[model samples]
Target: MKLIVNAIPFAGLETGITRYVRCLYQALGAELGVQVGYLGYHGLQPTMPQAADPDLWSRQTKRFWGLPQPLIAAINATQRLRLERLLRAGCRSVQPRIYHETDLIPPPRLPLPRVYTIHDLSLVNHRHLHPKERLWLFDLFFERRIRQVDHVITVSEFVRREIIRDLGLEPRRVTAIHEAPSARFFPRPAAEVGAMRRRMELPEDYILFVGTQEPRKNLPLLIRALALVKQPTALVLAGWSGWGDQAWRQLLEPLRLEQRVYTTGYVDEETLADLYSGARVTVYPSLYEGFGLPVLEAMACGSPVIAARAASLPEVAGDAAWLVDPQDPRDLAEALQGLLADPERRRDFAEAGKKRAARFSWQRCARETLRVFERVAARKQARRS
Candidate 1:
């Protein structure tokens, strides 16, 4: 079957969504009977030869927006017109059995079956989000997109439930496909781990937390917990700081734990894998998640995971990691301390986590996703017939 994938997000800096889309494309591309074409502006100028290059699609899309507004708007209009022209160009080129909008944005109302992947309801659920963001979510995007699409795919059951509850849609219309950590997240050798640590200037022994420093991550509670821990262990906060950088700084300032609290803005995948392998433990005490990718990644890397018992986390972590009440700093602290104090427990968790992580793979996700596509296409075809 012919497939048209909205791969616009892949052109931008790598994000969770971009990674998801790229991996899905690669996994599905090799299958026996499928043809996939990406539909979106390349981040380059219309006049440039690169604009027509499929490999440069992402870059061209970015550059399109970088142009002056009037020029950009005119170019965008032309692009849209061209897309319609191209879509109508031929039955062969246009008769895609499946149209997948990988990003949240729905494609123009199309004749073919359409599928949308809803990563999270964060814009609707996040209390700390800006008003404009809330407005865009509630008033502008998701509700209408959900109604228009033939099927919705979410990352986790938690998100699926949230979508059904919030949007009053039938649960059957949404499929929950659990995400997988990259293959690179698996255990690295000790010597390579040491080299990574030296490269990143990471402490010999540290407790790692990946994800943004947003209020939703409940980082302050983790910071408070760290204060209470008596061990010589340091806390490494990776990922870009989210909403609470000032508060995070204030919390860590007077504790004289600057040496103990390391904030690496963002590390590359190689260093990240090393950091994960070498960490005493990886803690993810978030208040919410659609699916906790970091927990899975840590587990896959053979890092003992300490995660919150809230939202989709417990479901993601299962019996592989330490589950704690994210709201209680004391409980988190005790859990961290307990894990650190016991070598046997860490080893058990580490070994179990690796095994658990092995069960999830992009191949499985791709197969499930293909099923959803087929289901949606069949439903659409039936309606037409």
Candidate 2:
């Protein structure tokens, strides 16, 4: 079946959504060949800004938000208009059987069946957690625009339920297609892991937390919990800094954990795999997530995971990782201590996690997603008849 997708996300930084689109299309292309088409701006793949240097991180944050609010809004409007024009022209040429909106923003009304992928309703559900501009955009456009689509696809069942309950979408109109860790995330050899650890200047034994350092990630709680752990293990924050208050650093000084924590800026997937393989245990105590990918990634890389028992994390981690209350530092600390103290338990968890991670694959996601597209297209054709 012929398909067209919104390529707007490719114009920005490499985020979870960007990765989702890239992986899904790669798998889809392998099966469908030239049936897939992309519309909108396609710039050079955006790289994550390195944050190993504090000053560089600060400058990048300032450069992003330094623009006047009114100017930023105008730019956003112009970009959207250009994207819509591109979509209109591309649709005429490609004559696609289905249109998939990978980004939340909907395209102009199209004759063909349209499917939208809503990663989460965080802007509506957790407004306090997002930036002001994001809230304004969601309030003004997203809720209304989302209703115009024929079908909604979510990254997790929890998010699907949220979209159904909160947005009042019909259960039959929405589907949940789980995402998978890339093939690159696998058990790395000990020698490679050792060399990577040395090259990155990471501690001999460290607890790994992979993701952008933002308030939503609950890094402060992880830092506090680290202080409480009995072992003198180091904590490594592997991803770059995202937009949010840098309160996690403030806590480190007061808690006397300044030296115990290390930030590796942003590393590539290969380095991430090695880091995960070398980690004593990977922890992702985020406040909420539509789908907790790092938990699966860590498990796939032969590391035991400890994730929050909130939102979709339990669903993602399944029975493999230790689930803990995200808000309670003491509870998370106890779990960390218990897990670190037990070698046999960690090994068992690693095996169980690998098995759990294996159940999800990009090929499977593409197939399931394709079924939705076909169903939507068939129904449209039936209605036309």
Candidate 3:
């Protein structure tokens, strides 16, 4: 049976769900040997920003906020409605056996089988971190659309439980599938690593944190931890900026970490591999996570990782990373110091991490996800008979 997977995220940022959808779709068609049709944006026309658009929140927010905000929302909603109507017509014509929306945004309700991947309920569970208007948009457009789907796929068991709890769906209807780092993430050669270090002007010995700059990431606490570390290690922030008060930037001046903290903004995949490979310790102290992709990617590149033990991070990190309390900078500082001061432990972690990372693969994620689609398709077929 043929499947239609949304490829809308291919147009926007390379972080979070866009990366997840792009990697998952590539594997589904190429590795799983599934007959798939590409739908939504790219090669054709306009589509909503995929996964988490770094600019989505600001685009919706007006400087003053009372009248212009609502006016803009009304106009944008009208445009989106027209585009979605055309998209629904296109999907009806293709009439694929299954339609999977990898991006969290749900599609227009269809008669055919439908599957949606819900990365997390962070916005609902941790509402303070997100803007008010952003939450309203979800409730207005995509909240009910989630209930209209045939089944739901979650990235981690933690998220799967959240979906069943928050959405009040039958446990059987939701499934948790693990995500993996790409083949390009493996340890790079010395020559390649050296070239990337020089090109990016990155320090040979530094700590790394990869993710958007948002309140949920808890970057300010990380900066405090960096200041406390006895070792002279620079901290690198990779990925694009997202919504949230970046007053964290002001802390740099007072803390005297301005010279030591660096940002690569957004780097290409090959450069990402080099960045991960060169770090002395990769730190991810986010307050929450759907699935910690950076933890897996750093492990794949043989970088020793220190991640928050909360949520799905421990599940993804397993025994590979040094887990820390995301709230306490002192705890984080101690962990960083220990890892940096000890070379043998770092060596041991590097060896074990590569092996741990091998357990997850995009091909495997594709296979399991296809099984969900096949099960739904089979049920539909039996009913028609």
Best by lDDT: 2
Candidate 3: TM-score?
A: 0.90
Count of backbone clashes, every candidate in sequence: 9, 0, 0
Estimate, for each residue in 70-125, the C-alpha lDDT of model 3 and write its tens digit.
66556546655665665576666666788787754666777678898888888779
Over 4 Å off in model 2, which ranges? 42-62
Query: Which residue runs of candidate 3 sit more than 4 Å off their true CA positions?
Result: 42-80
Q: Is candidate 1 or candidate 2 better by lDDT?
A: 2
Instruction: Work out how many backbone clashes candidate 2 has.
Output: 0
Cα lDDT, all candidates: 0.76, 0.84, 0.81
The better candidate by lDDT, 1 or 3, is: 3
Shift in Å, residue 305, candidate 3: 0.2
Q: Model 1 over residues 12-54: C-alpha lDDT tens digits? A: 4454776687677667776534577766553222111211233
TM-scores, in order shown? 0.85, 0.93, 0.90
Query: Which parts of model 1 are misplaced by more than 4 Å?
Result: 43-93, 130-138
